[model samples]
Target chain A: MKYSGWNILKQALTGKKEWAPVWHKPEPKSHYETIVIGGGGHGLATAYYLTTEYGMKNIAVLEKSHLGSGNVGRNTTIIRSNYLLPGNEPFYELSMKLWENLEQTLNYNAMVSQRGVVNLFHSDAQRDSFVRRGNAMCIAGADAVLLDERGIRNLCPFLDYENSRFPIKGGLLQPRGGTVRHDAVAWGYARGSDSLGVDIIENCEVTGFIIKEGRCVGVETARGNISANKIAVCVAGSSGRLMGKAGIRLPIESHVLQAFVSEGLKPILPNVITFGAGHFYISQSDKGGLVFGGDIDGYNTYAQRGNLPIVEDVCAAGVAIMPMIGRSRLLRMWGGLVDMSMDGSPFIDKTRIEGLYFNGGWCYGGFKATPASGFCYAHLLAKDEPHPVAAEFRLDRFKRGHMIDEKGAGAQPNLH
Target chain B: MIINHPLLGPRDASEFIYLGDASLIDRPDWNSENAAQQFYEYLYLRDNPAGTIRELWFHEYGDRSWLVVTRNTLTHEIVNVELARDIDREEKHSR
Candidate 1:
């Protein structure tokens, strides 16, 4: 049923029993035209686009667990297009545009709040770098503004401007960037795809892939062997392991990134603020809790947890930037596995196998790139060619010495 | 987390810097016929297994020595620790 205000009023006036479940639990079929692995935000979005835009049929999304159990639900929910590189700016800008019309398109309230995002600058060099980034954002048709110290103070007066080390300088502001309800994105996409005759099978883990000759055929799952004409793997952190089952080694590593939330209090932060000298970024949630995160734990691990050093380091950076939140008691913290690619950029391309495709290596920035990532993956699956914006995100870019390393941090995944 | 450094006994894991898979010690031969492919695999691909694996760690804040730490990626359990130079010499002798 369409979720309209009139429908809500009728349901309220009635016994409220006419409502239906958002999505149905459908059993997996023996064969499908396309199979999308990992029913996270990207996979669901891919299925949604494949059905709605491309008019494809017989698509099934297989999830190891329930939907939104991965990085899609684990992110800090901030979205922005304040990128510096040409290879990254346009693609993220496309995603920003998609986020603007997401709720209306899906007929769901995603809570996409464009409260703006400010990347703080601590030094003159940092300010120059931010200026360059703002120019890039503007060139890519995204909004960007370079705010001075006075401007930043006017926006957030609680910042520690007089700190002896790394004092406040300026920031690059993107007025069209802010937060969204993270898990709701997954639910909205799943419901929309399910309504369009796409089967979403949860708790069905894909154990391996079936290869015949040089072409991909199907997948071997915990439930049963299912065949598909095309199989697209969109598992974020499990990319390395899942592709390894097909004997395809990826240029990706799985690392744990931790996020923290403080006890609920009166809302203070007006926008998402990122620390310049450190890896800390924070924004206040609608629930009045401060949502923040920092650098990933510098190690290779599939375990969905991090060590204490990173937590302490992130808290220290938080205090160094905004001294006002020093007393807010830490409420909860959790970790999510991130597919850190070698060049720190993502890949949305096909593999050497004929019918197999891969879409992962999102690092810690997968949440914001959900819409574009799905749309591009669907474009690739439907037309057998990459979308214009994601043409550079090829699997062979690293092998061809065409790495899109945004940080220029070389092949070190942890540093990126 | 604590790293049982081979020389420094037990120490906080923060005192060391992680450099990823120990297979990095076997840098591909640049003059080989398949240099490009070998270099690509060496620089990018990793056997990021869920179980036990060998990795390189530098004692940056403790001692100026590199250690090859074998640990389980699933449980973060340290299995063994040895000086990287010793492991390098042993591998060279075996090779």
Candidate 2:
């Protein structure tokens, strides 16, 4: 296997082996260290990092539903740092690094395949955008190679070369990015963090917060109340509804994102291919089946399942773009609710509320940022200081007008 | 191969997301407003009763791009669904 910078960076991060005091009975134990809400990959990874990297094991991860049942498990499992924003690029690159060595760090097989992903540019403007993004990634010491038709064809042969409106020009290939088993990742972090003594409270929903003297004293879960000195909200889909209860108005929209799978076939797609023009993305799984997803449902909906139009739409794009795939029949489809932020970027910064931190609004790219988000958020929560990786996601940026809106299309995908 | 989606209207005028073999017309920086009309006319805009409407025309104002539509060749009926835009567009002719 060819080693990339992603492999080098993955060697840098570490996880904890210690655990915080568990609270089986709901009650404030004097002043526990930290309380992380939303026990998905973000929450679990945050706990593991805080305990390992920060030596702060006095932490608890509270999950409303079962772990890995949220957006973390709902993602298509693509991990790449091919971002265009200056502020956002390095952070996701850091995420890419962490993903490179995730198997060893977690001591679990995440099934991470760095088969490579190419963002095809069909126009001059698109090429220009790729140039800027590639330069940025290169500056950050990440791989972002520009490939021509020959290169693209060598990567994916079954694509249609003729009879298409937008003929192929070239693409941006990020060798560091690829795919992973989404659910196994969540479980690996949970098992790793649990071994370290971090409490993984499943089916424990945070109904509200206990605030005294303008500071969050504890959380009110379905089981009851528990006190902590600090708290972090890492939930994605239900982030809005959860924050609303605390009177916190976040610029987050609950958007439904979905994915589809084709019945098992002799593997054809070699790597992940994303269309820069339309909301099209696809990759062949190890099971010899095609797995893919696209733009989030623009509407705000709690519906775990979407309508029939999108399934047909995504598969249509798949078949239209690649003629060889026309015969592959779609097998199953699913939905995931994501916290679509106003800037199309995440908010991994301290909130206005005292002792409150947030790690959400990852949009469609959260899975790619799993390790980086966890490591950075752990640094912030444990030391009460922001890490370099997540400094760009500061809440003040929104206030300071220095927001890192890479798409320049604002928050909406239709607009972006 | 020909089917009508409930959400997407029948044939040309109907705004449906296409989950079939189609491509975006190669145009330089076409505005979103014109891109929709141009894309429809280029790949999807067709007769009252035609073959499977392989290309898409999603009404982005609502439900966003998850909607997919196709027209039946014989009955002129429409078949549509909310699909993940997992399809890859043929970029060779897209520009």
DockQ of each: 0.83, 0.02
Error of 2 at A39 (Å): 1.2
What value does the interface RMSD of model 2 take? 16.3
Query: What are the per-residue Cα lDDT tens digits for candidate 1 across A368-405?
Result: 99999999999999999999999989989988889999
Best candidate according to TM-score: 1
Give me the runs in candidate 1 sitting further than 4 Å from their true place.
none
Model 2 per-residue lDDT tens digits across residues A1-416: 12345654654453322233322323323346898998888888899888888888667888887788888877788888888777888898888888988888887778999999999878788888889889999998789999988898888777765636777778999987899998888887887887777877788889998877778778888877888888899987777677766667665655568898889988678889987556889998898878888766554455666656666667766766787878778888898877766678888888778888888878778888888899999998877778987888875565456767887875332233
* Per-residue lDDT value at A144 in model 2: 91
> Which number leads on DockQ?
1
| Model 2, runs deviating above 4 Å | A1-31, A411-414, B1-95
Give DockQ: model 1. Answer: 0.83
- Against the true structure, what is every candidate's RMSD? 0.8, 12.9
Clashing pairs in 1: none
lDDT of 2 by residue, B1-95 (tens): 23233444332332433323233323434677566545433332112112344434454444455434444432334454324354334344353
lDDT (0-100) at residue A398 of candidate 1?
Answer: 84
Q: What is the TM-score of candidate 2?
A: 0.77
